[model samples]
Target: MSDTAHEDPELIQLLTPEGELREHPDYPLDLSHEEMRGLYRDLVLVRRIDTEAVALQRVGELGLWASLLGQEAAQVGSGRALRSNDMAFPSYRDHGVAWCRGVDHKALLALYRGVTNGGWDPAEHGFHLYTIVIGTQALHATGYAMGIQRDGAVGEDGSAVITYFGDGATSQGDTNEAFNYAAVNNAPVVFFCQNNQWAISEPLERQSRVPIYRRAAGFGFPGVRLDGNDVFASLAVTRSALQHAREGQGPTLIEAFTYRMGAHTTNDDPTRYRVSAELEEWRLKDPIARLHAFLTREGIADEAFLKGVEAEAEELGESVRRDCRELPEPDPLDIFHEVYAEPHVHIDRQRAEFADYLASFEDAGAEGGR
Candidate 1:
């Protein structure tokens, strides 16, 4: 671990809950007024996206949704820290990072709506499709980073890969294996762990005794923990980490200490496992609220602009609702479409068999009508 990482032993905070700004000497920041407001906009808009998706799930428009509530700053901060060339591998809940990668909200919704296997081309956007499996993206990212290294893409002009997983996923074998692999290979990857305190009812205490980031040290790299609710800290630390990776410094582990602030998914009830008091406490460190407070306190955003953001959020909500409804139901056969990049004889035979099986249903319906 970097010696300076211990400077803020408890937590790395650049923005207080009260909206006051704090700075770390190791991480200097100079954001334009517009840039700061833009960060706030990203936070608000992604939160709105999360809200709309949850509502869609409730209405049965979506099969399921993994909410990114209360972790907007962490996602936005790290996401925006990436250069366009940097690749991101996200877990199912990283809608905010997807938004930063310029993925269309409609496309993201398509997956939840069960309309598309994946909404966007990853290569085009430099963002991989959401990985539903817990910690598999870690291995995927590490492999990609090693590929980038083999291709001589590990310098200032090169690219870095970041993979996100929750605290619960840290216990997974794949995630730990990725950590060890990246360390040994000096892969240009960042293992971003959003320790939202619960892996579906299992608290952080139940997961690990040492801080998640500190585990990077054992693997032979630096790990840093930051106030995940503080957008400034998230951005600054991630940006620096990415730079380190690009410069051929080995992998870094970033533990964003945050809260889930909602159910594990539309299907799970957070109330069943946690108390209201815990929720209320994290609410005080709400990511969007802190950024808003900073903007208002620093006079970077005015009443009109703030109101405009709210109006925009409402507009976004409406658009998501309308467009999601308009999406065409995907063909069941589409699943066989991308099973492979090239068709093999076996896949072709299987597809034909499946098509015949599907057609039999139509034949039965015709016979019934007769």
Candidate 2:
């Protein structure tokens, strides 16, 4: 193990639970009134997207949906911190990050609805498709960072990559290997882990004995923990980390100490593993409430402004519902279209076989009618 003294001993916080502003020595966020309100808007809109998706899943429009219910600030803060040149590799539940990357929120429904393998072109938006495999995106991110390094992309105009994972991924071997590779190669990647306490049903204590951020020390890089519910802390810390990586500094591990207020997915039940009291406690620290409180307290926004945000959120929810229902189901043969970049004889043969199989079913139905 490496020395823990190098990392912040406690969680880095900026905005308190009660909406009071506090100063952090290392991560200071100075934002204008407009910026503050903009952050608030992002939080509300993202939460609306999540809620709509969950409802869609419940109504049989989607096969499944991973809820990012309480981790909005962590996703939005780090997402807003990225520059256009920066690449992001996200886990399955990072709908908020997809929104920040300018991806059509409705398009994301295609994956859960089983209409498409991936909803958007990653290269177009600098955001990779959601990775469902545990901790694999970490390796992909590290490899991409290495490519950036090899391409001489490091300095002011260069790019960095940020990979988002959860506390559950910390226990995976791929994640550990990625950490080693990034550390040794000095790859410009930020490992942003949202330690939302529960990984499915397992608690964080089952994943690691120590705070997840301190794991970076053993990898020969700096690691810091922050109040993932506080957008100010998340944005400031992620911005600083991205800058450090772009300037050729090694990887940094940012463990966002958050809570998963909902079930792990549309399938799991939180009541089975966790307590109601824990949920109530985190609800009091809700990300949107804190930011709204700060906005109200600071006189940055009035009742009208707050009401407008609620109206916008409602509009967004409606839009998502309409768009999700409108999405066309893909043709069964469409799956073979992207299996190869260059045509391969074997895949062509397989596609033909599948087409013949479908035609046979149609032929049988016609003969029976005759």
Clashes of 2: 0
Give each model a TM-score: 0.96, 0.96
lDDT of 2 by residue, 1-370 (tens): 1211123458888988888888888888878899999999999999999999999999999999999999999999999999999999999999989989999986798888999856898888899999999999999999999999999988877899999999999999999999999999999999999999888999877779889999999999999999889899999999999989999998999999888889999999889989887788778889999998899988999999989999999999999999999989899889888778899999999999999999999999999999
> What is the alpha-carbon RMSD of candidate 1 to the true structure?
2.9
- What's the distance in Å from true for residue 189, model 1? 0.5
Clash totals, every prediction: 0, 0
Tens-digit lDDT string for candidate 1 (95-203): 9999999999999899999899778999988999999999999999999999999999779988999999999999999999999999999999999999898999898
Q: For model 1, give the 10-residue run with minimal summed lDDT.
A: 1-10
